[model samples]
Target chain A: GAGVSQSPSNKVTEKGKDVELRCDPISGHTALYWYRQSLGQGLEFLIYFQGNSAPDKSGLPSDRFSAERTGGSVSTLTIQRTQQEDSAVYLCASSLRDSSQPQHFGDGTRLSIL
Target chain B: QQQVKQSPQSLIVQKGGIPIINCAYENTAFDYFPWYQQFPGKGPALLIAIRPDVSEKKEGRFTISFNKSAKQFSLHIMDSQPGDSATYFCAAIKGGSYIPTFGRGTSLIVHP
Candidate 1:
């Protein structure tokens, strides 16, 4: 409600199974971002959405990773045929402006591929 | 290449000690720098930020020292406490770009 919200706080799935992670951004926030964080590693940018412009998917690691922001409010990140390497904490953030503004983050969804 | 480089993957300090985390960047276009703190099982939250125009900024016990010439910046915690233990991240962002480059993060432990 007041902050960026992510669903499925923890998800454990078998390898090769598909999964979808959801993010509900703060009200009136026009920018949303997705990132992957490995154990004791830096955040790897996954995708970015600004207003109505086309999402910047350049940081996606593979074709299996895709995301979409519907109605400019909520977004979902989907991984197809997940592999063990895909196991990581998927973080979501929302900002009033773009990168120039501070982002509010949610307690990310921890996705495990077993 | 990692645009932002952070040092000391892990650190430990006694209560009331000062712990500093360093980060460096190679991008000249980066104008905004921010630090985030994340606790166990939680995402990072913006702690403090400084622009290139200012050399340093202070908020509470957290201080950010920026050196534009060296393209390096550091975060200092004054009188750190056990409650301050967490992972810290340094990020650099350029104007007109939506993507922000983040450092590998530093894990700090303030022991009581």
Candidate 2:
């Protein structure tokens, strides 16, 4: 694709349930990132993938958050036992370079945990 | 810990005015500073970026002013327009790290 793509543009899940969000980065981009945006809050780093694998997962809020990428292209973020606080926009971006270049972003999936 | 701090949570500017938003970071290791513009129900897009080596960078109506000594940076939008009304964010990334720290965005309202 010409740009990053995210699936399930909006999702409403019950509290204590689990949800999954998908992201498909640019064709040749080797670096992918996941970020969360809450109301009145800034973009919060969640995790990053470099060629189908993640090297940094420190930003995940808790053990309930997990992500995986396959074929160095498609990525999925899974949240287990969703909480109301998890309601926010989950954004995905990709860059040609690992960490030094500008990133192209997706429209993002707005998750509303009820 | 929040590495970047942004000021003026919201601003209202008349068309043709220049709206300036400021940001400061505590980390000296940051090498790149970029500003992003976001609209309601949309993701943020990169507006402009500046490196620590450069004091300023300009593109079209947007300009970035950098102060390495103070770890401060600012975005200036010249000739602000109603379409320019959106949320703006300042972000910093260390040279070797892929994760960028973002500051709480500033909402800009360019009234006609």
Candidate 3:
């Protein structure tokens, strides 16, 4: 089966610009999560979506980082006014509704801010 | 406010050697612990997972030793190979929450 898919495997943008990263979770997956991995760092939680419930945005580093899951499927993570420090690999994962279920991850979109 | 803590930021071992990675968590509410392996330019894939009920679980060359009382767990790779070189992450998920707190990754390099 097709696993989680992410668009724009590599993205390069200028500072202060905006960039959008897309993720397509596996079919029938009800839980989606977004994470950021900086150089030599761990995965930083960004946001989470499950079914129709409200998303948990507490992990979002700043207001400039926002994400939206429309129709309970595809998700888009947008970073506004990008900064040099914003450069990192954005990863998306999906899993069954159960919290104990293992999550499947996409290759991720590497965003570079110059 | 990091719930899960991992040690040994990096490790290097011979092809036939065993490499161990450890993780500790403060939250007892966490019921599931999973380890993920990621290679360069690739997403992480689930290596093995264990529940609080079991003290250890082994699949293939990977074994997860979990200590519920001590709130700690470790991944032991038996006879690791150069192909096993990658970044490993440990994560714990609460019973009802969809989010899983991840620990700092361990970069493992096995020389053949």
- Top model number, lDDT: 1
Q: Which prediction has the highest TM-score against the true structure?
A: 1
Q: Candidate 3: lDDT of B100? A: 80
Docking class of 3: medium
Which lDDT tens digits does candidate 1 get at residues B2-108?
Answer: 89999889999999999999999988999999999999999899999999999999999999999999999999999999999999999998877878899999999
Index of the highest-DockQ prediction: 1
TM-score of model 1 relative to the true fold? 0.98
- Model 2, A31-59: lDDT tens per residue? 99999999999999999988755458999
Candidate 3, residues B5-60: lDDT per residue as tens digits? 99789999999999999999998999999999999999999899999999999999
lDDT per residue for candidate 1 within A8-77, as digits (tens), equals 9999999999999999999999999999999978999999999999999999999999999999999999
Q: Rate residue A27 of model 2 by lDDT.
A: 95
The true-versus-predicted C-alpha distance at residue A4 of model 3, in Å, is 1.0
Interface RMSD score of each model: 0.7, 0.9, 1.2
Sort all candidates by DockQ, best to worst. Answer: 1, 2, 3
lDDT of 1 at A87: 97
The lDDT for every candidate, in the order shown, is: 0.95, 0.93, 0.93
Docking class of 2: high
Categorize the docking of model 1: high
